[model samples]
Target: MLILGGTGDATVLAVRASEIPGVDVITALAGRTRQPTVLSENTRIGGFGGVAGLTNYLREQQIDLLIDATHPFAAQISFNAAAAAATTGILHLMLIRPAWNPTTGDRWIDVESNQAAATVLPGLAQRIFLTIGRQELAPFAHLQAPSLDTRNKSLLASQAIDLWFLIRMIDPPPPDVAIPPGKILLARGPFSLEEERSLLQQYEIGAIVSKNSGGDATYAKIRAARELMIPVVMIQRPSVPSGEQVETLETAVAWIRKQLAIRA
Candidate 1:
């Protein structure tokens, strides 16, 4: 089995399925993160060059099945998985975590993309806590970065482009990136309630921003903000093309087992 594992659920699923009686599990990680993890029995880091590299890996490794449990925003890799599955005649499954839905007392501001989220920043609140992950932040920076070169007035209609951002990503944000001063927090979470509380007080955070990466690991911040009556700005998960997507580790394991049983 070949598991494209990077997201927390993907990592859990890959690690759990490694114990199957006759199955050999190989997990490919995006390797954007440098932290240590309890991954599967066999692991390879970094991208597989695109569709061609991925297809070659599938064929060379004799992978019988492929599972795409990547981050919700990893569109290109997901596309590669779809195409490779078709080309190699191997089974594929996508494990997508359920997106967070609205509930009472949740001050949710929905945006189409990260860029849209950036645009919404001015009026919503200036002192914000952003949890939209490292790579997805590019859209916001692109919209916000000031350059003297040419006119890109299309994105400047609102003039709300001057809003400040306090970004907190898993890894240290890119130094080369153009972010406003005194606005970057280098940290990872499952942020503790106390920690979140402290941050809210320290930063005087009026708004919280996040993606619906549903799980206990990183939810404390949201809870803290809610208690403090801070508004939360959320970016909804991107839609994945139609597929059999199981969310939990248990279900993912069961689905893989059923596929193996059917093959037998």
Candidate 2:
């Protein structure tokens, strides 16, 4: 079995799958983070080039089942996995955590994409807590205070909210990337509500920008926002290819067992 993995649930599934008798599990990592959580199963890092490269790998390895346990926003890899499975005539399944929904007292402004979220930020608040990962930070960089002599006055005025961003990510951003005026917090998640509240207070965050990457690990921030009555600019997830998807690890494990049993 080949599992395309990156999320915490993926790690759980990988560990569970490794324990099953006669199942050969291999987990693939995207290598985005500097130090990824180590998986007990055999692991491969980096991309497979593209769809063609992935298809070639599936054939060469003679994989029986392919499980896409990638991040929900990792649409390209998910699509490639589906296409590669189709080409190889192997069974494919997607294991994804469901997207988050807003409850009462939650001030969430949903936007189609990161760019749209950036466009909406200045109107919402001046002090922003940007929780979206480092890769997507470029879109919001324009929110930084511009030079006084700049000519585009209207553009400057519209963007001139003088936003201050607080970026939180596990890895430090590359030096060449242009980032908004902000302090970066280098940390991993499963963060506590107290810690999140402290962060919001420390930064005096008026608004928060985050992707709807649903799971409990980073959810404290959302709860903190709700408690503080802070508005959140949520970037909606991209659509992924349709397939047999299981939301829970038990169901995924059962599905894998069924496939392995049939093959056995």
Q: Provide the overall lDDT of each model, using Cα atoms, as 2-decimal numbers.
A: 0.76, 0.89
Query: Which lDDT tens digits does candidate 2 get at residues 70-147?
Result: 998999999999999988889999998989999999999999998899998876787899988888788888774432
Residue 166 of model 2, lDDT score: 93
Q: How well is each residue in 1-264 modelled by candidate 1, as lDDT tens digits?
A: 998877778777776787788789998888887673547658888889999999999999999989998877787899889888888989889887777676666777887777777777655665667777666565555333232224643434434444456788777756665554347677765679999888888888878778877777777887787788888878777767666777777888998899989989
**Clash pairs (backbone) in predicted model 1:** 190-217
Q: Give the residue spans of candidate 2 off by over 4 A.
A: 144-161
User: Model 2, residue 85: what's the lDDT?
Assistant: 90
lDDT, residue 48, model 2? 99
